[model samples]
Target: LLNSNLTSELLYENFLKTLLYSIISTVPSCVFLFINGTMLFTLRSKPVFRETCRFILLFNLLLGDTLQLAQSQIHFLLSVCRVKMVYSLCIILSMLANLTNLISPLTLVLMPLEQYVAVCYPLRHASIITVRNTAAAVIAVWAVSSLNNLTRVLLFFKFPFEKMELYDLCSNIALILGVMTAEYDRAYTCVLFVSAGLAVIFSYVGVIVAAKSASTDKALARKARHTLLLHLVQLGLSLSSTIYYPLMMSLSKVLTRMVFLWIQNAFYVTFIIFPRCMTSLIYGLRDQTIRPVLLYHLSCRLKVIIRG
Candidate 1:
């Protein structure tokens, strides 16, 4: 009787802890969703944002970030609730999540590259980073990410899915069953990050070198350097997301199940959800053009809630 009572007490305590963690995870997600949605609206509320090269790029970044954040939170909730999904539906959700996850870091490279051109090649900035070209670059980013996912989706066919129609979870690792597919994912992630890091590095060095030039606008060059630095931080956060699952799976081997659950919840908030929301905060605080408008939208939202 005593053992049974203690066991029941412990189980009840764990249930409460999980409930608390889920609430904690959801609160910020809701806040950021509101912020991201407003920023998206603000970006389109004015002609300058629509016409400006940087603003269009910002819109693309936020759009991906916002969509991915929603998808990620939903996935997290599903996992927490122990909701099973059909394999076909899981593939679609996981693919869309992966698609949006790649967009921010990929699009991030272009934004600061725009800064580099404006600072290093002032004469050609207008021609090089026009809205049309920026749009093209956005399209190209989506195309590349989509193609990569498409390849993975095709590779998934190699696995015998005719047997199991329901999946315990929906994720890249959950869907990608073939040894070749997993290797391809790791190889692709490594190549993607290395190439992007190189491009951003070259852009960083170019801006720094331009900063030394007497003819370069010191203030603009300085801003470009700062912009490059921030993008690097954002890139680092995005890279951390890729490692979250593998790291958790590795740690689960040694840790106790309860401890693993605790750590996993914390890491999910830190890596998955946090990184997705960082873009909005970074741009909202960093850009002069976006600051007032973002704040206005935020305040108006609060006011509406207060009145309601």
Candidate 2:
């Protein structure tokens, strides 16, 4: 029995280590990819890019991603290292994650809407999506997201779990799943997912219809379509994380905790990393202006390496 207990402990520690390594590596990579690409683009592109509605949207999305990843990392540390986070700190991290949960998909929805306006109403797009208005939209998104998650956090605090010994032990998805076992938690989760999903779907549909009917320049139409498609893909990826919550809950009942944790790590590696990397690659690095600047940097590095 003692040997068996030791073996179980070993397995748990190994699983925690694996989760830590996976999150630390992949999440940071995604965050840095966005940061580096955006900074590079800003440096390389003219003042015009900074003022564009699309760039502002992208910036807000990246900001949301960074906050989400940072909170995830803290949760991972608390989980894997078995570090005890203060009750308030843990709650704050959970709230931040909840905020990010909304911001990402909402930002994605905005992207296609912006594209649709640019494509179907080119003459009026500027006036419709001015920088001041775009900034207000972003602020509104943040405000709405916070209030929604704040409701969840308030509901969470009323639970008796806070008095339990294991309350401090829970973090990351585990904490999320634990709190979500309540009926109200599930209701809120479904509401968040369904509402965001519908918004993205409606936005994409509008963009597609506009793209098809627009008598605009073919190249412009194609670019608009491509941009909308990218947003669609990103939104799908964002929603996958939401889908994962229910999945992890189901699988945990059948699997050992260690095995379930490993499975969660696998999901993160596959789903989360892909969207984060692809967003930077498909949108930021692939921008016509940004691409040339990237190539120039690559060539310069190659020349230096050859000389060395």
TM-score (all chains, Cα) for each model: 0.92, 0.77
What residue runs in model 2 are displaced by over 4 Å at the alpha carbon?
Answer: 1-46, 166-169, 172-214, 294-308
> Model 2, 1-308: lDDT tens per residue?
99999999998978767666666555666555545455545543666667877878877887676566555555545554566655556666777777876787777657777877787788999899999999899998898888887777777767676464444434544465344545665676567557656665666566667666647666777777677667767777776666655675687689985677677667655655555555556755668865666567556655776899
lDDT for each candidate structure: 0.84, 0.67
**Residue 143 lDDT in model 1?**
95
lDDT of 2 at 20: 69
In candidate 2, which residue pairs get closer than 3 Å at backbone N, Cα or C atoms, i.e. clash?
A: none
The ten-residue window of minimal lDDT in model 1 covers 167-176
